[model samples]
Target: MERSVIHNLIAALPVAVVAVDHEARVSAANVAASALLGENLTDRPFVTVLRHPVVVQAVDAVLDPAHVSLPVPDPTLAAVGSGGYRNRVIISARGRDIPAEVTVSALPDRIGALVVIEDSSGIEEAEQQRRDFVANVSHELRTPLTAMIGFIETLRGPARDDAAARDRFLSIMETEAARMNRLVMDLLSLSRVESEERRRPAEAVDLTMIIGAVVATLTPHAEAHNVNISLIGAENEALVTGDPDQLTQVFHNLVENAVKYGGSGGEVRLELSRIRHEPALRGPAIAVAVIDRGEGIDEMHLPRLTERFYRVDNHRSRQQGGTGLGLAIVKHIIGRHRGRLRIESVKGQGSRFTVILPAKRDRR
Candidate 1:
């Protein structure tokens, strides 16, 4: 094959590819390889371009048939540090270390060898997120499970003959179990919302109706705390393209949070308005603000409010039956609708959580 044809073939591949000559010099490199190892890789010694010791060793072994059987570094151990026979290696490129899976194959007829590098940064990040998610879920579940087990043991033994103690322990166990259930439910909801975040909902939804339903649903709970929940603005139907159920969930979570955290005997207001432009939305949008009159969130905690299981007041949140995933769920739901969630708070005053959704343009 013509050299240009060969180079074009290599360039077409998604992974980085480089060919090394018998003298250990890079004879050919695809665009991806150049981009990965830096430009001007052609004719450079393979060792100089791939500085990782393990990667260099793997390439050298592939080039030299005699050392083909030489054991390569263990990939698991190689991942921990530089250099190894491992399939995964970290290569320094443009002052940044990139995680990549390396594959070395010897060419036919004692020719040079080919090295393919597949970037694995995204994979590693996703794996890390999975690990963290599992750990968080385990910790959340364990707390309640441990409490329930202890109560069970007490009920079965020490509190068997004590009706008052048994009753109290059972009540506590029930509460713990309920908490576990809520956490599981919230986790499921979060998973579903995240899975659908990239797909915009096409259904036309009325923000007014969604907010109204949410207020009606949470009114009793708000009344119990002497916190009045009121819906203001947008007398007409404020329509937006979204999923009604998810929109309902979005407002429910926000309004419920407002009522729960808003100070006792205070008012929680849900305000809606049509706007021509919102910086976050970048177009005409409908903005819904769930404002509360309770002790406001500190500025420091505002940025992390939408993070999963992040709580400003853990004890109070647990006491109030908060799953700690409410805002996280709301955030995801809003994102699915191509909307933005903005949090503004001031100490000792109140907080406002706003949702800005793009307005459906008139097709006329």
Candidate 2:
């Protein structure tokens, strides 16, 4: 094949490809390479252009010939031969950092070597999520284990002679066990929401009914805290298409959070509104807002609140019996429903959590 044809063909390939000479100067680069390393990459040292330590190492290994001559086989060279390099390295171009997975190989013509680059940001994100998941699970389990150990020790030693003390310890142990059970159930629900393969069609759902049920169930807690819980706006039949259980869980978490964290004498308000009208008259999207008059979240911590196991105030949250997974679960549930979840707060003022569910389509 002609050189131009070969160049075009290589350039057309999806993966970023670059070729360098024995001196490590870029002799040719494909379209992907041009786009990534810049169009004027020729004559630039592959290392200087790509600027990724791992890519540079692989290129240096292939060009040095010493790597091939070494008595002990180098894994990097073997990876080059197999055409599968999964090295994690940072690439900087124009002062911006880029994460990449690089594959390097010795060219047949000895025209230097071929380096293929693939963006690995998504993969790294997945790995980070996995790590967070494991850590959260361990932490959640540790709480129950610690309580169990403390209670068992009291029953076996200090509380053995006192019947009332032993009973109290046993009750506390039971409560801890129940908390662990709830944690497990929430984790399973979160996993299901995250990994659900089938998308269920949405239907008209009454937001008022869901909110009312949640409020009724949590009213005692609100009273116990001396906080007033009230629903705002007219009780209109607002409807949205989405999973009922998930939506219920979303409201339950939001209201429960307000009741738990809002100051002892503060008020919790749940409001509903519609936005942007349509022909089907599904009504404005059913928006439910949970407002709490409590210590609000800081602006800086807003973005990461939905991250799994994230807590704005770990000690306060734990004291209020929060699982730390509540917001994360609420976010995912809203996403599955094709809705938006937002948190607006001002420190020392209060926090408002809004869930906007798409209006149900009128099948008339």
What is each predicted model's overall lDDT from 0 to 1? 0.83, 0.77
Per-model RMSD to reference: 4.0, 4.0
| Runs in model 1 lying further than 4 Å from the true structure | 1-3, 27-31, 66-69, 72-86, 106-111, 278-282
- Cα distance off (Å), candidate 2, residue 254: 0.4
Report the Cα lDDT for residue 288, model 2.
Answer: 86
TM-score of each: 0.86, 0.82
Cα lDDT tens digits for candidate 2, 25-115: 8877887777777778878877678765556766776777555333234443345354334465677654567677677777665546777
- Top-scoring candidate (lDDT): 1
User: C-alpha displacement of 108 in model 2, angstroms?
Assistant: 6.6
Q: Model 2: which ten-residue window has the lowest total lDDT?
A: 68-77
lDDT at position 167, candidate 1: 84
TM-score of 1: 0.86
Query: Where does candidate 2 clash, by residue pair?
Result: 203-241
Best by TM-score: 1
Clash pairs for candidate 1: 54-83, 54-84, 72-85, 73-85, 75-86, 263-294
